[model samples]
Target: MADDTGNLELEAFRAEARAWLEANFPPALKGKGGLAMAEITFQDADLATWRRAIGEKGWATPTWPKEYGGGGLSRAQARVLQQEMGRIGAFNPLMFGMGVTMIGPTILDYGTEAQKQQHIPPIVRGEVQWCVGYSEPNAGSDLASLQMRCEDAGDHWQINGSKIWTSGAQYSDWCGALVRTDPTAKKHDGISFILIDMHQPAIETRPIKLIAGASPFCETFFTDATAPKDAILGELNRGWTVGKRLLQHERASQTGDRGPGGGGSAVALADLAKRYAGADAAGRIADPDLRTRVIRQQMDAKVHGLTLARAAAEAKEGASNAASVLKNSATHVAQTRAELMLEIMGHQGLGWDGEDFTREELEAVRGWLSGKAMSIYGGSFEIQNNIISKRILGLPDSTGST
Candidate 1:
């Protein structure tokens, strides 16, 4: 059966994927139940099975070249793969961290043949977890002013300073980070984008507990952490270009506009409305005024999804900067949906803790809080506005800075 599935042509791949998923993926991991279930943890066997299947088909990183351990599938085939995965309600096995999200794409764009050969396969296979080390205590919004230094030592660079808000750093095996390679140069001029081994003695990570009690972000410190001279991702003193490209990919991923089962938010929202307010609840969803708002939000979510698809198509057609607008717009729409979901719940939404809080309420609160950071993290809302104003709109550069 596996061999037959493997031999499937483009048309047959979707059918095979659907059949395989039906047979292999548990019902609990399928459809609305799979997403609504509060637990974020995945069983090792389940993860392994899904990863092996996606990895074999290169559906994990579908558009990447075959030589660098990708599925070498056409964009059309990749879309089919996504549709099949969505039909089965199979969650993305690579959605956990930066390995698949940021680093993998960055390496594909800027990495040498050697680097691509070394890095891409493991990441696609889920053998490695990577994290971003872009933010520092004082250097988040104004990222170029970062003070983390990397000193040349003939064959290696000794790194020092701290990175704050390093997501999943404690569990990450590698970090694609920015460090100051030349202190005398201007803020952004001398920065170097380098890959750092997270298991080294000089690295220390302390998780920062959030208001929700779980800490997904960490403070990472480096004390003379050594990286091989070849760890540089792009040109030595021209890392700003590489960093910007990586940021573009990160922003695109955060838009939640790609991959299989991507429309979970809309489905979740519909489920919440029906379960909480009922099918014909007055002034809830059936009420004319409230119904208008609900319908508008649903339309907006659909528009956002379609816009993302257009942007992806544009990217594949050589419009590289299309992601910027799609990302900014998608984040705004998602935040709006989160707000509406809470509004639909009304009184029940107010509760943050305790068993009295329904799963919907808990999710709403966490999502609302997290949505606040969506505008800030992958370049702030302000930053995106500036990009649109200057680059897309051809506005005058009043600030004289990027």
Candidate 2:
């Protein structure tokens, strides 16, 4: 009886969601969710309007609390909202921001009431862009070895040093960073997480263009930058813990926690193969080997989706170690698809730009090129393997420490 009642209530919510989305989601933006970028999120009038609409409705973060300007929907209802949004090809305009994916959730996890009041509302409203400061030139995977320094000032905190591969720093209004707060302590123990304003003169960002063309990554230097004393997240010298927690959030978002249909309008593998490689008499891919490989790729994708769904259902209010496992899996599925796509497109996939190829084909070439970084970013494949073995499987670290 309870289950039946819940189902009835969810059905009512679904109907309500359908109506509300139909009225509020702009027709011009339908099926165009993949087109919005944080740098230009507000550049187009229609896209800005769509962002404001969804942010205000708080459906951009459906399962978050209402107090923080979130929709306050239950997990079940959030799923329903996603289903309705997917029904019309509507995407979360704000999901592209690292604020929503990594920093905001970490704030909610470890922030004080005052900090939450200061930050989460702006995030939920899509009012600011955020970047992360973790990787240093010397400390890519050994992030704990990062030397970016933070110190106590009489009235404020002083920040110095730099971050490399700081994604979206040029456009970000703020940064959530891991810094060395206690230099005398162990590398992992001396870290502190803090929030910094990007607008100050002490900070400068230089963009790093990748082979894929325009990129969001930058080398961000902080020369005696400043933050309020309260800007430190969690306890002083306890940021390694906080930073790991944030990584879990990062991995989860990378694994598609951005809600249903949040992956954008990416063409399916089978469809792409059928279109590019031609088809057999029975409608399989024309090439027998390609057909089998495509089927396997599709199956792998399906397994990742199912695993992700199950994990999401079982996950609690913050992230967990399981995210590490799923992140690698997601990377595998995505990279495999990109490889298959390029092979199926043959020389046609080699298009850089010209009238000879379609926009999707051009993007496919770039995607295939950029896809190589998947195993490197968001923690490397080896890093994730270490995490899985040590944390999940209770294996020992290289130092013979558990």
Candidate 3:
């Protein structure tokens, strides 16, 4: 799949990629498999092998610059690689998290050449994991109001604050966090984006349990957690701008638009429907009204996916604001799919946990509950609507009902 002479057609690249993945990626790893297949775990050795293969080829981050240990492929070629990988049912080598979704993009766009050279390669090779430290207990939607203080010293900064809803922090090696660097300035003015070493003795993470019984998120406490002077991501006291851009990338990834491979809720939903609602179950499609709704949702998902592709293509050509629309559409699609899945399962979807419940039933309930956050996180639905109106439609801000 290497574009050696810079003239290889996408079709040829895809053919080569498909053959390579088929030959290498285990068949069991492909597609949405059954319960047993889903239960199959990839250990450290397995993950290392996959990461090394993809990292060596720079295929893990194909569109990234070659100097940063990326494939240096064009967007078109990257799409070909994704399609071929999907064709062979190859799971993405890099695990999804704040690292790939948020921090990596921020570093790429705003970091100095030296910072990029140091950070991007390790991330591309899965050598480290990262988390975002944005949402404090009091400052989620109003992120500018964060109170995490990073006091300046001679060589480093002393960070002290609590960050809530930090996903994967317990497992992360580092965090791309927002801290108040200048208390004298306005809420948005004093903040700086800094990379915190999670392994520090002063840093602590306590898992926060959710309604779904999973605690992937954490409450992180930084008590004089020190970050080197070089750890600052962008201009000092101008981190909000960099942070917002990173959030944009984070939102895009959550919506399944940005990142190494495109995101989709359809495959997961369809699999659930097939398993819980059965191939031709009455609840699945017998009701014309429900069937119409499902078809509409499926069409909408496809449209959203295509819209994301279009936006990404435009971005590659230097367009701005395409991400806003794509993010809005993708989040809505995901929320709808979650609701539809629950509806399709009906009474069976109500179970929380028990041996009596099948895996499909458990998934339906957990997914339905978790899906509620889709619109809220990554900028709330109201915020997205505001962006669309002001930025896309050129409408004035209004409190009045449409």
Candidate 4:
């Protein structure tokens, strides 16, 4: 009886949320939200209006602090908002940038009062974009070995180094970068986390083309670029701690739990298989083995999602490296789905672009290619395994033993 009552309350809240969204959300922009920058059509007036409305409402950063222009929503309420948005095919007006998913959460965790007031509001409003600078040519998975240098320059800092695989670097307004501030200290101890403006002459970005023909990544160069002295986040020379926290947030973002953005919009694998591979009587997928695989994948995805919810429920303070577990699981689920998509579509999924294949088919091929990199980015699968081993499992260092 109590569970039934609680569910009734939730339904009432959902109805209210649905009504508000219908009245306020622009009709022309339905299903057009949550697009990556590369996928967005800039000329659409409706998109702009919707962005403003959602940003002003503070629902884009729903779980962030209300004082920082966030929605002040509980996790349950946030889920309701997501459900309501998905029901009407309403997309999140905020673009899929590092600001909301990665940087904003980290800043909220570590930023000073002034930094929070200055940065979080703009981010919550979707007024700016951010990129992370952690990886370098010599330091990808082993991030503590990074050599980007930031020197004291009185009122500001002079930064010089290059960062590789910086997603959306070419168009970012600011960067949350990890740099070496003390050469004499140990590799991990010498680092600092700082924010640097990207619109300066000393900063340059070159996009890296990928097999998918679309790229969100760039190689970013900093030739004595300037950052205000006050831009340091957390403590100086303790950025390894700060950087790890940021990565925890990042891995959380990549886990793809259906948040305010309603990220899981891809066609169901079973439905696709039925459409492409034909269906048996009673509307079941014809191939017994394929149907079993789909069921297994679906079960795994649900368990992964439930684990995420439990983790979210447990973490009142902040995320830990346990996010690494979710990151690996999400990578597996996403990559598996992409592979299954191709298998279902057969030759049709191989099409790139033309009238020859459906839009869904072309997207599947590209998605499969792009999904391959998920295990590599945000720290590789092997890196996550190391973390899970050393940190979570309390395993002794293998190198120390030999």
Candidate 5:
């Protein structure tokens, strides 16, 4: 049942959104979405056109504030826009960046007015790429142990040390990094979150090749890489709190609750199984066990979606730490799909590159390899469970215990 005026206005908005998408989004990219991180060829005319169109329209960050070049839509309106885009198979080109997923949100939460004016517009425009510099060679999972020094240098802060597993560091224009600012303070207390330009001479990036065909990960070194004195995000030596918030944003992005489709694939799982593994006499999947697993995964994905929607409805502003729950669920669903896709594709999935395997199959294998890291990234599965146990479950902390 639909109300007269409100329903009509919503319908009108949807129609307008659909028309804009149809006019602007390239036909080739409709179902394909934005280029996958590894496959991003920024020079492609179609991609460039689509990215520019959405960025300028401010639809790239639909729920963000308009002053920062965001779409200025309410949460409901943003959801509608996403639905309209999804209806047409259109994908947001700018959603892939750390800027969109992590940095920008943190900036909005804690940045000074001047900082927002300087950074948010470019981010909203998709004009820059950002990498997170959180993991150091020594820090890794124990991020608070980071030793990247940021020294006071009057006009700028001199940074020194290295970050490992920095995704997109080589291609990034900027980095939102966690650095140690005060050695005398507590491990988590003395840290600061800073924004550093990646194009400077003091910063260097080396790509780290993975077992997967493409490498988005990098080793980023800072030898006196400087951030402007005012570039420290949040209060000086209070980055641990800021960093945690950023992680929440990161987890939220991974859970797919914020944007279109909850990051789920357009192609249904059963369809893939039927296509690759073939069907039985009754037109059901031939493999009984695989069919069961696929059904369960589908159900789990649905449950995860419902839970996310519920969480969204409950939270008036910021999300709860329960994003960690969704993150773990998403990891499970994705890894399960990868495993099933490989099984269904069988030998076709094994080839890295050849005439024998379809592009989709090759991608599946690579995606499987890449998806394996999802558990490790955005806080590992174990870490998320720990969060769930303590934060969500109210379990006792086992620190300094056997």
Candidate 6:
């Protein structure tokens, strides 16, 4: 049943990957994927170097077409790369950028040849960052009810409106935004997805501070943000389809398909429990009740990981109804991990700031706070349930709405 030649070749490739990763991955940044999640700017030499190395090697966007500067690894080869990186406690620093997760894949799907040539390479190279402008003040879950005006200005398009909860807008170089191009048309029909340049003065971003301290979420305003006439993604008024497709991509990223598991440099919950709460004679968590709950949470996390792997194996591309199911599952695993961690730390985890708390303790408090949004963003928990009922369960849409 085994392909000997193929197995031999794969093993050879694995060796090459291990060597390359050893040569390139910075030891100081090992298991630091949490830093990548929080990083909006590159200031550290090691971080910058790691980004450059991966970008040049095209491993940052591995499996994307090589013509666009991606590694163009086969799906199997990509998994091998992931395993190698995990072994070294190396993670893709580029995961912080929305360019790879939402925008780049959407562009590949909906963009023209010229658009791909111009945009995809820079994204793959980690030379640019992107944000999505979807949720307006009034259009949070009801995204179709957007009111941003995108006027055809002969030579270019002018965008005038605000997008709330625009994550990373303050740092993004570009934005893929939806705008009302035909006000007279129906709500969904009038919307067109456009690629906007964020460097212009017409665009302003105000970061929304969170309970966890500084965050990427921002309130973005466009007084008269301009884009090229050719900046429209897909057909002009058919952007709802493109927008929905991008949402699928966003869900996929949250499903744990990307990162190597070794990052975050985090202490295992059990280890933390033993250290902070004291270990029993049997080397188990001292408290019986807390020990049972921690074991349950870890089981749930493992089940979630396996389910993700199954969903990935079933289909490597396209939007599947499984996304809704797994998206919620991912939120559960992440949030539960944070909660269990906080509980394990007990009173010490409550520290917002002080010399009394360890760095991990302070971060755990923030992480727990920030993890609350996991249920809401990327289409909320309730939204995913509705999707599952309709798409996966063959239930009717009772809300009589999109």
Q: What's each prediction's clash count?
A: 0, 0, 0, 0, 0, 0
User: Candidate 5: where are CA atoms >4 Å away?
Assistant: 1-4, 34-36, 39-42, 261-265, 400-402
| Candidate number with the higher TM-score (3 or 4) | 4
Rank list by TM-score:
6, 5, 2, 4, 1, 3
Descending-lDDT candidate ranking: 6, 2, 5, 4, 1, 3
Candidate 2 lDDT tens digits, 1-402 = 999999999999999999998998887777766666533534677778878988998888888889999999998999999888888888888887898889999999999999999999999989999999999999988888899989998999999999999999988999999999999998789899999999999999999999988667999999999999999999999999999988888888888667744835447777788898888899877888988998898898889989988987787755478888888999998898888889988899999999999877887888788878889889999989998999899986787656
In model 3, what is the error at residue 271, expressed in angstroms?
A: 8.2
Output the better candidate (2/6) by TM-score.
6
- Candidate 5 backbone overlaps, count: 0
**How displaced is residue 310 in candidate 5, in Å?**
0.8
Runs of candidate 6 exceeding 4 Å displacement = 260-262, 400-402
Candidate 3 residues 1-402, lDDT tens each?
Answer: 366555557667877777776665555544422221122232544445655677677787778788888788887787778777655556565536566667887899889888898889898776787888999999988889899999988898899999999988888898999999999999889999998889988999999888777777899999989988999999999999998888777767765644333322325555555655565644454455666777898899899888777766556532266666777787778778778888877887788878877766787678678777777777887887888889889998787789
Q: What ranges in model 3 sit over 4 Å off?
A: 1-8, 32-48, 258-284, 316-319, 354-356, 399-402
Better of 1 and 2 by lDDT: 2
For each candidate in the order shown, give its overall lDDT on alpha carbons: 0.77, 0.87, 0.75, 0.85, 0.86, 0.88
Superposed on all Cα atoms, the candidates' RMSDs to the truth, in angstroms, are: 4.4, 2.0, 4.2, 2.3, 1.9, 1.9
Query: What is the C-alpha lDDT profile of model 4 across 207-274, one tens digit per residue?
Result: 99999887688999999899998899999999999998888878887886636755434468999999
The CA lDDT at 296 in model 4 is 91
**Residue pairs whose backbone atoms clash in candidate 6:** none
lDDT of 5 by residue, 318-391 (tens): 65887899999989888988898888888888989888888777778888998899989989999999999998
Candidate 3: residue 359 lDDT (0-100): 68
Taking all chains together, each candidate's TM-score versus the true structure is 0.88, 0.95, 0.87, 0.93, 0.95, 0.96
Which one wins on TM-score? 6
Ranked by lDDT, the better of candidates 2 and 5 is: 2
